[model samples]
Target: MLKRRTRDFHQLSPVANALFHVIAASLAIIAVFPFLFVLIISFTDENTLARNGYRLIPEKWSVDAYHYIFQTGDSLLRSYGVTLFVTIVGTLISLCIITLYAYAISRKSFKYRGFFSFIAFFTMLFNGGLVPTYIVVTQLLDMKDSIWALIMPMAVNAFYIMIMRTFFSTMVPDAIIESGRIDGAGEFQTFIRLVLPLSLPGIATIALFSTLGYWNDWFNALLYIDNPDLVPLQSMLMRIENSMQFILQNSNNASLSSGILQNMPQDTSRMAMVVLATGPIILAYPFFQRYFVQGLTIGAVKE
Candidate 1:
């Protein structure tokens, strides 16, 4: 009887496992479908895209849209360079400022830590709104139409600083700091040599976050930038989308000209532009993901 019961349980287990696998597979497909569709659409020929919209497999494959974008060569290449430069410079500046501020807050001896924390936390909950901030950026700071507008306004994020401070307080040993002091290391030296090395995971995590923010940002460019030369990849993608929409809506507009408008593949071009703009970040993510996960896990635990 016991053997029969065991056999019955074993038989049921396989059926249950199969059901679970079916559900998990369905969820995975649902999550991945949009990305797959975008990739398919990017390669689809203009005529097929205009006639049938997107398909899992392209009826006809053409690199015409990509060719056109690359034909504009220097424009796309220069935008890419600007994006890379801003992302790198902005991430480094943000990381340095956030680390120093977080370290200051983490020190128990800092007399005004609580007051400073309150001010930082307060800004998270409330802000002067868009108009006032715009006035400050454009009028007061005179950052309008410049790359500084993109990098300066959001250089330091308070929440990230707090997370870093929490990680420092919890993970870094007090005795290690004391030993460094005994060795006659100055405060800045101790922070540079000891604190930073130990805080690699947190720093990398924040750097990735800041870089992603800078890379994906378009609002700053939209509001301030007038020179086409200064546009970042995201802003250029937005312009491409808008231009495609305009061409679609006003297909009759004389400005398009006959042969050029007829040959222009708006739908496929939009998808291709999206792929081009986002391709770098997607390719770069896996390398940084492990550091991001480690930082989040370490920073999450409180002292």
Candidate 2:
């Protein structure tokens, strides 16, 4: 039956098949064009960009933007390290917490599932305001200026828990759990050994989401962190942009000459920061591509 269905699925006419391929290619190009354009603009000369107002092929190309970003070598590297640590640790912690909470709520046998699920869902509709949240993180929790400030706030996402819960409820059968129990497996053992192995696609999808959240987060750092060493990559790039703006704004008052300011790669450096920040994260997509698609589609389907 599967083989026959596979054979029948490929029975498109030559014109139709060609049209489909063309559509796919066009969509792929549309998605990739923005990144390619940003990369090109990063290498474009600041003066040329200002004069030409963003061209596909600028009159002059320069690496001044990259040079400016990398000028503070030690700080940049430290920021990269901090960002990497946060992304990796935060994603893992988020996955563990989300998976555990979601799986527990997904089980029909769990009596308190509704109570816990409601708590998670309630957070989605509303949150503690910024001032209260800041006070809690800074004063109550005492996480101010620490790396934990970045990791803890984003650690558990209600939306992700919901996704994982749906995936578990839809995809993982109760029979499997009963079988694990029959085999004398404890709840933890069954979850770790049987359930997790079968839930790879769903887990991978959640991991990718968590990774992007951690990698792109700078707001938490702005609110709670002042330590230079703990500042993540996005926060560092933001500071660079802010510094550029301040210098440009006060260039007249400061001893810095107009020529030096004019030569600075303000526009291109912003684009450069975008390219640098997004490049590594983009590489991660291909790894999760298959699982992400499968997870969303399969989990969304109701039995």
Q: How do the residues 1-303 of candidate 1 rate in per-residue lDDT, one tens digit apiece?
A: 999999987775778889999999999899877776887788899998778777787789998888766766687788898898889889889998999999998999889999988887888899999999899999999989888988988798999989999989987888768878999999999999878877877887888789889999999888888988889988887776787678778878778777877777777787788788777887667767776665455532234
- Clashes counted in candidate 1 amount to 0
* Error of model 1, residue 7, in angstroms: 29
Candidate that would win on TM-score: 2
Candidate 2, lDDT over the whole model: 0.91
Q: What TM-score number comes out for model 1?
A: 0.81
lDDT (CA) per prediction:
0.83, 0.91
Those runs of model 1 whose alpha carbons end farther than 4 Å from true positions after fitting are 1-36, 50-53, 71-73, 290-303
Instruction: Indicate the worst ten consecutive residues by lDDT in candidate 1.
Output: 294-303
Q: List the pairs of residues colliding in candidate 1.
A: none
RMSD to true structure for each model, in Å: 5.8, 3.2
Model 2 residue 288 CA deviation in Å: 1.4
